[model samples]
Target: MNAHDPIRRCILLGERAPRESLIRLALSPDGAVFPDVRAKAPGRGAWIGVTRAELESAIAKGKLKAALARAFKTGPIAIPDDLPDMIAAALERAVLDRLGLEARTGNLLTGAEKIEAAARSGKLHLLLHAADAGTDGNRKLDQAWRVGKDEEGSDLRGLALPVPRTILAVALGRQNVVHIGLTERDAARRVSETLTRWLHFIGSHPALPTCETVSQGASALQIIPTGAGNSVADDDTCEELE
Candidate 1:
């Protein structure tokens, strides 16, 4: 409920946001930082990050404008489409960071190694897998479940500094990380939210696919067209972003 969440602020400030300590608001969600959620323009700033459904609900009920009005310390800044992409991106980065760390520290176990290691370990505080993994691998996990980035660090392996997509971006001295496990401290909690993002699209499977870009499953990944329609919510050509 806290409006000034750092990640949400990052969404507001986009690239213009300072990465370090506390800073003031940026232009808007539809600014250069991201081309989505164009409604938050030219007006003052307010932060709100709970859940996409919740935000959408607020919009449906008109509570969104009321809250923004009070928070902006004035009348509400015009909130365009309640595009939660900024929040979604933040969550996605969180997942990538976790996957990256598991790759870096040797904790992330992909392929058969993930299942073999988990089986050998017995009961786990948390379980994880991509939403898109095959049914064959899915059957292998005793209690394998989908994990979100928010759940990465705490319930699963303890990681420090969260997951970094760079680890995944670079070849493991060879190929980028398709799968990994986090067994190190500091890195565990950092990657929870990130993992949650992955679980959103890829379901939780016991073993990581032998390859990246796993096959899709029953998960509600494309619940809506991302980015494509945000700028044009009410048939308006997203003036804020342009």
Candidate 2:
């Protein structure tokens, strides 16, 4: 992170972190709390860096209400019982929307052949797989990425998204988007930022396949080297075929 990167404090966690890394909760005129994943809502907002389970627990114990009441300076803050789910859904949408934008710009590559070529050429900045993509397919592409990066013996691999191929296809307006390779550095950074926040918020959802979990295969995608000019990776434009 740059020395001038904006920072915010998480109300529940009481820890300072990069503003974009935390989830923002915007308040309606009636003091209803809503997810502001894009951070574009024009109003006072509170931030939280807790996971879904932690948020749910806070709500059950009335901690979140108290925190919001304090943050919004209101006696009664309206928090929906489904606030955690709402946040998760909003974050998920943000990730998919980003991928769509990147896809439209032609900054990414799909299809096993194309991705593998980019990976082998060391031009692939970020690699990702649909949750339901075949394991053998993912491994093949991951090995190509590692080989390109010259980390042949390492565990570097593509991320297995929490959503399946059907959802990915709809998001990118393509069919059977089993894997993706972002070729632009900026594009990779942007996508990685969005994906990181979503994964951090959701923690370990069951939809993520164990074999492709970040801890298992894609840990290298979590943080880009500071010298690489970004703290995370994933953004770019790409037109997907098939």
In terms of TM-score, which candidate is strongest? 2
TM-score of each: 0.45, 0.84
Number of the top-ranking candidate, with lDDT as the measure: 2
Please estimate how well model 1 matches the true structure, expressed as its whole-model Cα lDDT.
0.36
> Counting only residues 3 or more apart in sequence or on different chains, how many pairs clash (N, Cα, C under 3 Å) in candidate 1?
39
In angstroms, the error of model 2 at 12 is: 0.6
What's the distance in Å from true for residue 223, model 2? Answer: 14
Candidate 2, residues 128-223: lDDT per residue as tens digits? 899999999999998999888888897677879889999999999998999988998878878877887888788853222112222332321222
Error of 2 at 48 (Å): 0.2
Cα lDDT, all candidates: 0.36, 0.75
- Once superposed on the true structure, which residue ranges of model 2 sit more than 4 Å away at CA? 205-242
lDDT of model 2 at residue 104? 98
